[model samples]
Target chain A: MKVDPRGQRFAAAITTVVLAAVLVSASPWLLALQAVVFAVGAGAGVRHSPYGLLYARFVRPRLAPPGELEDAAPPRFAQAVGLAFSLVGLAGYLFVGAWLGIAATAAALLAAFLNAAFGFCLGCEVYLGVRRLLPAGRAA
Target chain B: MAPEQVAGGAAAAAVLVLGTVLALVLRRRSGRFRAARSRGVVSAADEAAEGLRLTAEDIGAPLGERATLLQFSTAFCQPCRATRRVLAEAGALVPGVAHVEIDAESHLGLVRRLGILRTPTVLVLDARGAISTRASGQPRKADVIAALGRAVQ
Candidate 1:
């Protein structure tokens, strides 16, 4: 399965735009918009089209060496990290106020942008780091 | 800077540093330190017959006058696609050579039994149904032809 890099770029662009709109609008309506965008993007990713299937199946595997196959998928960790960031940001917004939440969100968005642009998976790196610190048997 | 703002900035910085350090330490300690092994090519005879559980009857039954070439592939395997193309071309070149592609995902148990850890594996069997050569990763055209020649000889 061959992955078209352009497809990934397009998906990232859509995710960024939707997320930005949600943050700027800061309204209940924005949540609905975000949900719609996410659903459409995820649906497209899973579509049977050649590019979509290729992106879903082959893109991430090509990132590593041939023999060093990933023991587990990376997206699961990315989702966990994303959820943690969202919760922390929400807490900061509710308790510390809008400015702090905005700052944290901006920082996170910047990091995500850099990662997508440069192919530097910060979340994966962090996950590997944490895995290393765990006692041998506990680490996955 | 206001005293309160300074405190806040310092706190955020502390959190960031702590998070990064913890992540790094954890990753390092999580896995066993294992050195990589060499990618040594295996001849047909060198392959463990018991582990493979693949006999001449199983492979030879499908091959009608033409020799049989079985290729194992994985979903996300780039080299596997390349190998498929190469084997397809080889099949065209050799008289009575047929290529069969197998998805490793559906046959994980077989893969484990064969001790196949990598994708794009090519298995060549002679007309008599004996395994001739087993190449891992993308095999060079010349090497594959040479192996076939040896098997026929």
Candidate 2:
């Protein structure tokens, strides 16, 4: 299945806010909340992703149909990447130190910001790089 | 705000500013393709096609009869879908022009060799498998047509 590209951007916009809040609050709890958000989006398909639902219910109805929809795998992979960063960052803040938490959120913030503002996919590019390095079809 | 709070605020602002700048640069670069060396000669298509070398293995699929609009895609790049549609439609309009979409990761070897830095990168190939032109980002219909003009000349 495919997704409206705008939905991904809408979700990214929300992520940018949550990640930015993590930096200001410096609270493990807040970061954990953001991490859980990532987990849900990554675990469920984009159709069930909270931000996706938000886009479907509130945003899509207000706009014209998308020019075309994109494949689901890449965005799903992107969500997995986000989940990894948020979870690791949450771990850093909780067990390691404040600086790690700040750093992690900063990284995630950069990615979310790029997607929302510029439509660049830093994590998606990283996903490709990783796939290139690994032997073909190793896990799946 | 406290000293720590001031520092955090500064970082937050920095993220936003950097993001804005990055967006500007990407916007400038997206969907622009380099012009081919079309000499306006009737046989120029054959000349361009001479140096081309691609097969089903290179693009993860077979080439079209007269030309191929080979597209490189990734699991996460959204623009690839838009580019695919344009290429597909263009291919249908022009006889013998075929569109092939390749997963960047699956064909990483060819992707790296071709210097494909982003998804939706397209390589317009002539019938003989010569690379006629390339666009690094999601391409517009006009540009695709122009590249096809060069490829199918």
Candidate 3:
């Protein structure tokens, strides 16, 4: 769908931050509802992200590289792994209570803000790190 | 559980669900609106003519001879629209303070020349045209005002 990486990242970050804020301020049931809403929103974003799509239609022939032109598709597995980490962080806060929860919440908040302000995905970095540790054939 | 606690829990749950749903719907709608395109390119020399190509001189003028608030925006930035409102209100509160907005899209060449990568960037310029502070996202009105005061002083 020709989604810009920057835009996708920004969306992801905003979603994560809002989710975290909801978790912090809302009741348990409310948090669950927010999680669902965030998941759907993220799913929609994934659908639109143009990570691998060709851009032949949008740009001039001279401006595009040879062969198929598609928008860059964000790495799905990588993004999923990032989302997973964010969930883990949130869950840790929810289950552990107070100090631990606040710590995890802070981490998630930092990750999200970093993605927004600097376009750096902490979750993606963690995913890549874990992926690197896996055996060759086991890596997704 | 106490009756009050039960009621509170239910209310909280309702608020959460409603807020999440509202946020989701808003996000979905906002996605349809794309950010604005960059303005025509400007040369290095042209950028030099203006201290910063992303900033507009007229808008940066002091607010009624008191304060100056400058907002850097792109044509299609939703947050920029919100930020503009906040600045306008702040301008109203303080006498002699002027709020200025610059469209990055309108001056794409200058933006590139100045190495701006993000839209809706705000820079509070002092009376002398030097940048006092810069914010990449929507800034709180109080923070902007405080920075402006600092810069003016």
lDDT of each: 0.49, 0.77, 0.48
| Candidate that beats the other on TM-score, 1 or 2, i.e. the better one | 2
Worst 10 residues of 3 chain B by lDDT: B30-39
Determine which window of 10 residues in candidate 1 chain B has minimal summed lDDT.
B30-39
Of candidate 2 chain A, the 10-residue stretch with the lowest lDDT total is A131-140
Highest TM-score: give the candidate number: 2
Candidate 3, RMSD to the unseen true structure:
16.8
Per prediction, the TM-score for chain B is 0.60, 0.80, 0.55
Would you list the rank order by TM-score, best first? Answer: 2, 1, 3
Candidate 1 error regions (>4 Å) = A1-43, A46-140, B1-61, B64-66
Candidate 3 structure quality by residue, lDDT tens digits, A70-114: 133232333454445446545654575434333433444455555
Clashing residue pairs in candidate 2 are: A74-B75, A74-B76, B52-B130
**RMSD to truth, every model:** 12.5, 4.5, 16.8
What DockQ do the predictions score, one after another? 0.08, 0.42, 0.02
Say which prediction, candidate 2 or candidate 3, comes out ahead on DockQ: 2
